[model samples]
Target: MNIDIYSPDAYTTGIPHEQFKWLRDNDPIHWHAHPEGGGYWVVSRHADVITVSRDFKTFSAEQGFVLVDDLPGDILDMARNQLLGMDPPKHSPLRRAVITRFTSRRLEQLEPAIREIARGMMETARNIGEVNFVESLAGDLPTAVIGSLLDIPRDMWPQMRRWSDLQTSASDPDLGGTPEEVNNASIEMGTYGFQLACERKDSGADDLISLLINQEVEGESVSEAEFASLFVQIAVAGNETTRGLISSGMYELIQRPELYRQLEQNPDLIPGAVEEMLRWTCPLHYFRRTATADAEIAGQAIAQGDKVVMLYSAANFDERVFDNPMEFNIHRDSNPHLAFGHGIHLCLGANLARLEARIFLEEFFREFGGIELTGEPAFIRSNMVHGFKQMPVRLLPR
Candidate 1:
């Protein structure tokens, strides 16, 4: 097969599952050349992805940062501060500090507020009748939830969303700006976060921002600069990925009316359906790691400093792990999808994303009697971010 996964255009219409399947079957550890320079190894099998994720000592997230594209020296320095891009000894303390706030107990306390946000957004969508589900409906809830968590002014939520979009959707003309603009958005966003950390540090406030800026783990506290990078990752990640989950998940349901009604009739089944959504419409396609030492993945010899990318979308459908992996079955007894990734670097907001998705579905079913696509959905033009950019739909009010 002529491999074109490197081009964002390959994913413009939809996921290239055929290519992924071919690669997984024939070359589980296939090496494909990057447009920018040399080649990198692509890990497509579920077990190998897990192996690479678990053995972070040999496959370092910090060496090259998490992105497949190499960043400039200064940008790499900024990215190293993010929890996703840090290795053990240094990764543990910061992760512990942030994990405290996202524990199950904390998420339980947060459920009511997230439900209200989802409820309000759904009601407004019902009132509008026809809307772009991605923007007017799905996107706002994440921004609101994260904004409320950090106590950011409501007025700034849209700006943060824009900045986050620019950073993640840089390959899309409609969604992202030029390279210079993208850099500016990241800088401006980090500056704003730094300002918040400075103001909230030692303030004894109860919001998430205060919790992060003031709390210490292993006798070390988060510096303002550190918090800035953390803030960018948290805010941008929460908004972009969660929005994709809700919107793309809904799009999938809209395609299958029977499943939609099944979910609507039994709202209790929404959690299971959410897991299928994460697997089927996985928000991220891949994340890269650099090898610290020569290693082997599925018998493929990898040299030190080689870039290895775990294809989450492909691994989610690996036949060895998931039965009838292509089918969107919500009743799978054991669905171990790598949508939130695996091992220590798993998504910090995993539970929060689940809570938001479940609540959004429940509230959406409550507020709207039925929903149908009014126009063809258009996906974002990016290889990394797999989601609909615009989904026009009419919501029939309950």
Candidate 2:
């Protein structure tokens, strides 16, 4: 079977796991042709993905990451500045400046508030049965958490969510806006972020925004432009990907009552459950890195400046690394999935996302007795982001 990993339609129908399995078994480092014109290497195995992620010197993220197509110049410039898009030397300082704030001790302090947010949101969701789980609950939790962290006003959370949804789901008509609207969302979000930075400049407020604005990167403060980019990154990622973990997670769990019951009976199982959900659903399919030097991956030759896409979804399901890689086992031992990319660019919001998912599940079981899928869910038409556009489900009252 011919596997076209670059096709958005390939993901819209469902993740081409069969194709991924074939590639892992047959062509571990497969050359995938994009219809746009050229082709790039698809690194399918678990080890190769880690190799590419860790060896930033060889596979550069700054030189345009996406394999399907190159980003437009202005956007590319902005992307290269993002925490995800920068290479080491420059990447470390900015990352270090903010990493301290997300440490486990800090997150532990926020757990109670996060739980309160989760319970409050679940209470509202339980009341509104037969709703789009995406919009009603999953969408709201992370936005509130991230907004609170940034000290963004409560009233603006909805707008922040809108901007996030638009950028990530731009290809999905039902979930996203027009091209003009997408551009406008970015400009408006950045403008809002810039405004916040200016207001908080030396205000001595201790939120993520203030911390970002005040931090010294290579003996220089992070500029408003950079803050705007990081703001959009945090907001979108916190909202979009967390929403995926919660909603997609429920979708999977509801289908397997044993697992659902297991989690409900033993809340301690949540952390493990969250890990499995991340691996099983794998919110994102791939993150692209550019070959800075001609490097060989899994014994395949890659030229300098060539695009190399790490197929995370494929790697997570590789039987070589994961025992019964296709099965969703909450208690699966030694689980090392790359749902969050490995190494330096490993998502900045990884801990926050995990916290949100864990608490969301805990509160969900505490409130609802059962979850019933009321309508067929539709997925976004984007290969890069793997998530639902709409998941209509009824919350069963206890």
> Pick by TM-score: which candidate is best?
1
Model 1 lDDT tens row, 67-124: 8998878778888999999999999999999999999999999999999988888877
Question: How do the residues 268-378 of candidate 2 rate in per-residue lDDT, one tens digit apiece?
Answer: 999998999999888889989998888898779999978899999999998988898878889997899989889988998899999989888888888989989988998
Model 1, residue pairs in steric clash: none
Each prediction's TM-score against the native? 0.99, 0.96
Q: Model 2, residue 30: what's the lDDT?
A: 90
Backbone atom clashes (below 3 Å) for every candidate: 0, 0
